[model samples]
Target chain A: MRKLTLPTVLLFIALALTTLSNAQDNIWTPETHMKVKRIGGTAISPDGEYVAYVVTSPVMEGEKSEYLSQIWVAAADGSFNLQYTRGEKSNNSPAFSPDGKQLAFISQRAEKPQVYMMRLMGGEPEHWVSPIPTSSL
Target chain B: MGWSYGGYMTSFVVTRTDRFRAASMGAGLPNLVSMVTTTDISDYLVAHMGGEFWDDYDTYEKHSAIYHFKNVVTPTQVIHGQNDVRVPFTQGQEFYEALKRKGVDTEMIVYPRTPHGPREPKFLMDVSERIAVWFEKYLEE
Candidate 1:
C-alpha cells in the first residue's frame, strides 16, 4: 500500500478551494438573469431581404430597474445588422410597408404609445397615428 | 409583428389599416373581452380596459381587434405559446379564425409547453424563420 504525502494532501485541498471559487463566480443570480437581453417581435420585410426585431434590456436607474426596448434590423443573409431606434424610451412592433420602402412601429416617446413611420432608406421617424389615449380607453 | 402588448398592437393595427402586406402576431390578445376573462393578468387588463368586462362591454368590444376583424385586409400570421396564461392561446386562435372566415390569408403556429414567450432556443429560431418565410410567400413582388 502507498502512503499519501503531506504536500499531496495540501495540493488536493488547494484544488478543491479553487474549484469552489470558480463555481461561485459562475453562479447564475437574479441580477445576472435581469441583464440578459431579450429578443422578440420579429417582422420580415416585404421582399424578405431583411428582418426587423425588438431587443429589450434592463435599464438600471438608482435602485430601480426597468426594461427599454428598441428596434433592430438584420439582413436575411446575415450580412448586416443595425439598431433602428435609440434613446431611453421604448419602441416596438415593427411593420414593413408593402413596398418595403418604409417601416412603421409603435413608440412611447410621448405620454402614450403612438404609431411612427420612417423611410427604410433614411430620415427621422414621422409620427403617423395616435388612435386613442390610454386614459380614454 | 410583436409579442404580448406588441402582439396586441399588431392585431389592432391590422384591423385599422391595410397598408401592411403581412403581419405576425405573437401571443396577442385580439379580443379584449375574452382576454380579461382568460388571461392570468386579468386585473391588469381590466384596469387597462377601464372597468370590468361586464361593467363596460362596449368599451371592451370597441378596443378589441376582433370587433374590427371585418376591416382587416392584410394577410396575418398568428403565433402563440400553447401554455401561455398571460395572453392565452385562444387569443391567437380567435384572430386566425376571424381571418379565415373573412377569406383573408392567415396561419396559426402554436408552440407546445411554451409560455408567454418561447424559452427554448429552437422554438425562438423557428419563430424568426417562419415569419420571414410567411412574408416572402405573400409579399413577393
Candidate 2:
C-alpha cells in the first residue's frame, strides 16, 4: 500500500462531498433549468383525471430579458404534459376550479402579476383577480 | 406544502424550514423531498451564516413580511417547531400576530422538541390530516 498524505486525503474527501451534493440536488430539483420551478398553481380536473400547473423561467436575450411562464398540463398519472399557455410573457399557477370546467392562474401578461382564468380547452381570456391591492393603503 | 400563498414552491423545497413548517402547521400537503442531514440546517439558517442567495433586495425581501406584517387576509393558521432554526420561531409569531390583528380566521400550533422536519411518523400523519381538513373547511364552499 502507498502512504497517503494529509492533503491528499482532504482533497479526496472534498471531491467526494461535491459529487454527493450534485447527485442529491439533481434528484431534488426535477428536470433542468425549468421555465418555472416554484409553486405556481395546481388544479385537479373536474373529473379528477387531469392536472395543470404554471411554470416560469428567465430567458436571457441579447439585452434585457424578463421571466417567461406558461401553463403545462398532464394526466393524473403524469402523462401527456404539454404547454397550453401562449405568448412569450410570464404566467404561473394554473389551477382548475373545484367544478373542473374552468382554470385559474396568475399572469404578468399585462406587465404586473395578477390572477386570470381561461377555458380548459380553448379561447378568450377573462381577468379573474387583479394583483393590485384592493385594500393595500 | 399545498402551494404557499406567496408563490413559494414549498412543494419543491428540501430544507428543514420547509418541512417543520409543514409538519408543525399541520399541512396535509405532501412532502416530495426534505433534507435529513447531520448538521441541523435549521441552526445554520438561524445563525444567518450560510451563503446568501436572497442577497439582492428583490430576492432577500422577495415580498418579505419581516418587520411589516399588516396586510394578511384569509383565515390563517400558523404552526412552528421549537427547534426550528431555519425560519426561526419569531417569524411565525409575527405572522400569527398579524393574522390575529386583522381578525382573519387563524390558529397557531407549535411542536415541541421537533426540528424543522422530523421523521417522526405520528407528526407526518397529523400534518397531512390537518391540511386536508383545513382546505375542506376554507377552500371548499
Candidate 3:
C-alpha cells in the first residue's frame, strides 16, 4: 500500500475542484425567461410563413375566474405582432391545414377544450366539438 | 378497433426517466428511445405480422424484410445514439451493420449525449439536415 502524503492529498483535491469547475462551465443557462408557466399552441403554417402560440393566464375563484389567453402570431423572423384571439376563453394549439388557408384551435370557453376553426382572412370561429373532455389538459 | 388491452397506447409516463430510473440518466446518453410495450404479447404479434425469426424451412430461405434484407427495394438509413435508453443503440448499429455487410448504400448518424427530444438546437438542426440530405439523395434518385 502506498502512503497518503500531504501533497498527494492536495493534488486529488485540486483535480476534483478542476473537474467541478469544468462541469459548471458546461451547465446550461436560460437565454430568456418566459413569464408563462406552460406554452401551448405551437403551430407552423403550411407555407411556413407564420407561427402562432398561446400564452395562458390563470383565473381566481369567486372573482369570475375567466379563462384568459392570448393568440400571438409572428413571422419566421419571430415578428409581426398580432393577437388572433383575445377574450375570456383560453385559446391554444393553433393548427394550420396543408394549404394554410384554414386554422384550427382549442378554447376553454365552456369550461372545456372545444375545437374551434376560423378562417385566416377574418371571420367568427365555428365550433367543431361540443363539451370537450380532457383530464390533465 | 377491437376494444381490448387496457395496457396499450393508454400507457405513458409523463417523464420517461421516472419510469426507468434504474437505467440511470446516462446509461446511454446520446440515445433515448423506448417503444411502449404492445398490449399483446409474443403470440399475438407473431401470428399477425410474423416474427423476426421463423422456424419454417422454405420461409427461412424466402427473401423477407427482417432477415433476407437483400430483397429490400426501399433505400434505408439507420440512426442510433451513443447512449440510447430504451431501444438501445445496439439495435440500430446491428441493422446498419447488416445492411452494410449486404453491400447496401446506407447512412447512419450516431448522436452523442442526447435523449429523445434533443434539447440542444444545433443537435436538432443536425438531425433535420441529415434526414433532409438522405431523402434528397435517395428519393430524388
- State the weakest 10-residue window (summed lDDT) of model 1 chain A: A58-67
Q: Interface RMSD for candidate number 2?
A: 15.8
User: What's the TM-score of candidate 3 when only chain A is evaluated?
Assistant: 0.59
Please tell me which model should have the higher DockQ, number 1 or number 2.
1
lDDT string, candidate 3, A42-134, tens digits: 888888898878876544446342336767777777657577886766788888867887788887776678889888767898997776668
State the C-alpha lDDT per candidate.
0.88, 0.54, 0.52
| Chain A TM-scores of all predicted models | 0.78, 0.60, 0.59
Model 2 alpha-carbon miss at residue A66, Å: 3.6
* Native-to-model Cα distance after best TM-score fit, residue A37 in candidate 1, in Å: 11
Better model by TM-score: candidate 1 vs candidate 2: 1
Q: Sort every candidate by DockQ, greatest first.
A: 1, 3, 2
- What are the runs in model 1 whose C-alpha is more than 4 Å off? A1-137
Give one digit per residue, the lDDT tens place, for model 1 in B1-141: 898999999999998999999999999999998888798888887777778989888898888899988899999999999999998999999999999999998999999989999765456556877888899987895
- Evaluate every candidate with DockQ and list the scores: 0.02, 0.01, 0.02
Order by TM-score, highest first: 1, 2, 3
- Model 2 segments beyond 4 Å from truth? A1-40, A134-137, B1-141
